[model samples]
Target: MIDLNQSDKRQLLFDAARELFLEQGFKKTNVAAITERANVAVGTFYKYFASKEQIFYEVYQAENEKAKRKIVARIDADQSPKEVVKQFLQEIIRTSEQNAILAEWYRNTEASQVLMNYNQECDVQKNSFVYRFLLDNIERWRSSGQFRRDIDANTILALFNVLVLLDNHKEEIGHEHFPQVLELLAEMIIDGLTASS
Candidate 1:
């Protein structure tokens, strides 16, 4: 018997489901598998989540929150704009490489579909801490004359999103080259955002 408190059981299920979803993706992962991995009864899954999709979305949100905390904690006003951008990109790449399960999910079509559905069902734009953080950083840089004032935060953020997607393609790009590619990407972003004379 899993003698855990309500919160502990919920966290156990969440962690198990997240790992399974990342490893096998949303389409292949089922409630039974999740419960079994969590050491809980199959029926107990319904007590926490309506479906596998629900648990996946919650897991996604939790992961995003964790990433946000890490990013925010690393921020420093003393750092140069380019340095900050490099740090952000490096952190993202490092996190993805360290978590093979997440990397697998990013390369899986079913996981992408699940993420799309979850984004559509949730207030993704408004609730995304990453987007909000990028927007704020862009505004700060522009005000401080560290970044080009011509490009709006939304456009810069869109470019950043593209870079993030590219980062997810490490297998195709070759693991050894991925870090160099990210460095080049960071340089390009910095060049584009640099204030013109």
Candidate 2:
């Protein structure tokens, strides 16, 4: 009963709405604006989604999934865990800034509310690609005697998450202080994990 053409039209709306949302911000965006931006009729918009919130959710979900995939693809298996983590952190920060939709979604949208309702189990594979890569590499490095055995995988995961969150505020961290903070943080973590080194 689902019409392919209708589905495509809906996606078109989502795409246009995302761009507009990034430019105008969510609180300022509305259903009429989305339809006009999509070059579709208001009735056409209602046929696909009842409101802008639903379209926003779709757009956010798609962007988040794409960003996660791109970040994971940037990781190299040959790299050490520390290097891999650094690459991931850099990629995420760079990609998020470059992708206007993603930047706006995180900065201006109700991301916390959407994330609360998002099904982690359903999104596990799409969302965890980078996480699994990071965790697996951490374990590999530890087993290979490259990193200290005392550093548990869970601890590494926590640190990686914290680093990624911190990287998002790099501008606030300031160019002069960011490197010093990162170096100090990395040294403390590595020293705690390293064996006799």
Backbone clashes, each candidate:
0, 0
Best by TM-score: 1
| TM agreement with the true structure for every prediction | 0.71, 0.66
lDDT, candidate 2, 1-197, per-residue tens: 54458778887798889888678766778898888887788999989886776677677668877788877876786875556655665676568667766665345436534533443325553456667776787788888887776767888668756654554455678755765566567656655666554
Candidate 2 at residue 48, lDDT? 87
- Candidate 1: segments with Cα more than 4 A from true spot: 1-12, 18-29, 37-50, 106-113, 120-123, 165-179
- lDDT string, candidate 1, 55-115, tens digits: 8878877776787668668877468877877787777666755664445445556665666
Candidate 1 structure lDDT:
0.76
Best by lDDT: 1
Report every candidate's CA lDDT: 0.76, 0.69
Under the 3 Å rule for N, CA and C atoms, how many clashes does model 2 have?
0
lDDT of model 1, residue 106: 50
